[model samples]
Target: MNHIILGNSLTDWLIALAVAVAVAAGLDAVKAILLRRIRSLTAQRASRARGVAVAALSSTRLVVLAILGLYAGASLLALPERGQLFAGRAAMAALLVQCAIWGDHGVKSWLASPRAQQAEDPGRATSSAAIGFLVRVLLWAVVALMILDNLGVNITTLVASLGIGGIAVALAVQSILGDLFASLSIVLDKPFVIGDFIIVDNALGTVEHIGLKTTRVRSLGGEQIVFSNAALLKSRIHNLRRMEARRVVFKLAVNHDTPEPVLRALPGLVEAIVSEQPQVRFDRAHFNGMTAPAFSYEVVYFVESADYRVFMDVQQEIYLRIVSMLAEQGVRLALPAQTIHLEGRPAVLPVPLPQDERVAA
Candidate 1:
């Protein structure tokens, strides 16, 4: 078929180019349709990432078909190195398969795991996806090394040289590697998972994501704080999300005009109010003694819900009831105030009735 007819001594290059383009286009269409069918079948069962990965790998079939078509056309035209033409195609397929493996296995599975379940962050997710892609690249290095060795490259010598150089390289990145490994520990130990409302040192936030070398926290005020995994692993993390209930303690001032009889009755009233609440438990209420312009009673209770709004609602109801009861007993709550004087008219009275009065009486 080496008949030089269409031009000045050439085997119809225009026809070859047209044929290649047409074959590539046909292969691309076939791949698109085939992937749609395969994915439709896998849609009901496989995880999203895995399904996408499978589809992506299937699409690479077009490249394979196009290359085969080219080789076939070339062979008919008596082209050179036809055996090695298929070698490059095989390598390309291996590379694609490697990527598919990472997307399907390493990354997608981690994303599917409960340990990685976090509050959605558009930016943080993009960052995590980038990191996942990088990890896959590192994994691809291993695959590439294997493929090179299979192609008759000297692996042992190459690996030895790389190992020597990698030591120094590793030294430079030791801190990063430490954090990465710590992140892995975080995933495995799972002392605190994502979406957990945690306080690490002074940083309080809901966990946004756990990444390769850092854990991201989205604060209550809509700020993002990135903590190194190493520091996070060592620090004290108070996970409020895991708490069954939150303990709240505060002092409610009693009216100075409230007599000792009413002050004594106050504890029972507070207890009754707490008892009526659904999830609030009464602790001891202490008559914490007289204060500046007011007598203070320390009330302590545990709320059943960790929700801040719920705690506030319960607190308001309990206090409102206490105020109504105090009014019934002719007691008004004392406001914070100070007694100013132009001159010292009279000294304050000493309480607890000095023991000397007992003997004198």
Candidate 2:
């Protein structure tokens, strides 16, 4: 065995191993300091150093573990110096890149999780999650390309081939690609979110699932409908989820013979019903011109909630109260009727019919 000894008995190989370990430790410390400075500068934090230190400590364990893996791989190649240099360097590069990327994603996800955030706004939370995922994907892609180039691969030639292939693939799957792109746009642009009720073309439903090719919706008619993302993106979309209020309009007609006092007080009575309602907003009430034997009035109000049941309840309450109020005011509802007068025609017609029958007898 060719073994190195310490002091008088120590040899060259032990010293080299010690030197490599020292170099790894120093590099790790320096990397931690550099990352801390970079994060501080970008985040504009001075007192956040402790938090950075804590994050680095946790991340360092993962990093150190990766370095250890590289060193072990390198040491095994040490039998041949020239071959070891190339093999060891490549392995070290791969390990460092993988670990760094892993740490970045790990730290960011830990921070953005609801468990980490003290207070969260839903809009900000969703946006951050989406952006974070995209950023992580891009970072890894860049790292992968860099590693390939380091391995002496012809990146330019590869890119060219990929581009040509991509064109053909794109042409073949143009419709599918369009839908995928549209889904990406939906994620980024955020016109609507999950659970939103929307109307697109003849389809009206709640958003159940969003996918690359198609978006699934559950219609109010107890049916599920699937739409191509490209088609849904092209259609005129109406989101009822964002509706502020619901409006109701109806006409009421009172007898023209009703008292003038009741006619004048109708607006105030209608307003009272609207104002007292739990979630109704009074818009207007007008005494329109007489229609034949009745006087017409148009009433309009808004329901505060988009809920159908709530709107119906408010409307029913108002209707019952309005009917009672009209009764109290002695104003009756109009009904269709006709009056006819018969004069002097019955006697002469009956005698002529009877005379014909008597002659036959």
Candidate 3:
């Protein structure tokens, strides 16, 4: 038992190995017991913190815990400087990676809370998704740096090199980067969201998806239109879904021969038709002006509903009523016609002589 092996007595080696195994077993038992308790709590009443704890604990690999135990036991041994350094670095790397895993789980659980899932408030949902992505990237980046530092890497030099290389990469993919940032802006600014009916220039559609590079819209024609996020942000966007009411203006024309009294009563008649319609507010009706061939009246009203179908139905009903009213009043709609006066005698056509008469002559 007094014989030395690797600078330690055989008995000392056995003690160290026994301690490593004991610690590993203890950690495994503890992890299992804690998991059972937390899971029970989760089943009783779910919470974001508890959910994150479950996810993080589940990600802790048995091998990582065993390595940690071995490192603890090795600390008591009289190992060489290099062996000690290697063990310490290995343990530290495993710990950093485990912490990163926990952080990742926490971020996902936090972002998936009820507040973040509100579809009615799309700005919050979009912001949460983007924020979660950025946080995970930052978390992993820090973990990588810490691991590299433990391995005795000179990070300052590496970071400076990456900076120069990053510039080159950025220039190569500037347009893609522009679109990514534009997508970020859309999430933050929230000009439009999924299910919003919007018009971008001549293209009108409902937003279906917003992505890093493009935004997809389902058009009225049932075709999907894709727009680059950068270009989409540049164009003017009309979010019709946000409108409280639709303003409608229409013009009516009556023949020039209409009676003066009938013309005077036309405005009130049309106003009555509009006011009687459901979901509409009549604004004004007036004898606008006399055109070359007819008298024109302009009518304006508002449809209280933002739905296009509702507006159209209301408009159609009002028009039909107006036509019926005009018929009752014995008024005819104007038609395009032109009148001209002869300032000189009208030209007469001469009759053509027959061919036989010309031969006899």
**Candidate that scores best on lDDT:** 3
Q: Per-residue lDDT for 66 in model 1?
A: 65
CA shift of 249, model 3, Å: 1.4
**What does the lDDT come to for candidate 2?**
0.73
Off by over 4 Å in 1: 1-37, 40-56, 68-135, 191-194, 220-223, 252-261, 286-297, 332-361
For candidate 1, what's the RMSD? 9.9
Give RMSD to native, each candidate: 9.9, 6.6, 3.2
Worst 10 residues of 2 by lDDT: 1-10
Give candidate 2's TM-score: 0.69
lDDT value, residue 199 of candidate 2: 95
TM-score of 3: 0.88
lDDT of 3 by residue, 248-322 (tens): 999999998899999999999999899999889989999998988889999999999999999989988998999
**Predictions ranked by TM-score, top down?**
3, 2, 1
What TM-score, over all chains together, does every model reach?
Answer: 0.65, 0.69, 0.88
Per-residue C-alpha lDDT of model 1 across residues 1-361, encoded as one tens digit per residue? 4656423235455566567777778767876777677677776776665565554555364455666556444444434464455555564555555455645464644544332432443333434564566677787777767777766689999999999999999999999989977876776567777677899888899887878888899998998999999989999989887788988788878767777888898888888888899888878788987877899989888999988789999988988998788878888878777777678568778666669987787
Tens digits of per-residue lDDT for model 2, 26-58: 767776787767666747754444454445444
Cα-based lDDT at residue 210, candidate 1: 79
Error of 1 at 98 (Å): 6.7
Worst ten-residue run, lDDT, model 1? Answer: 114-123
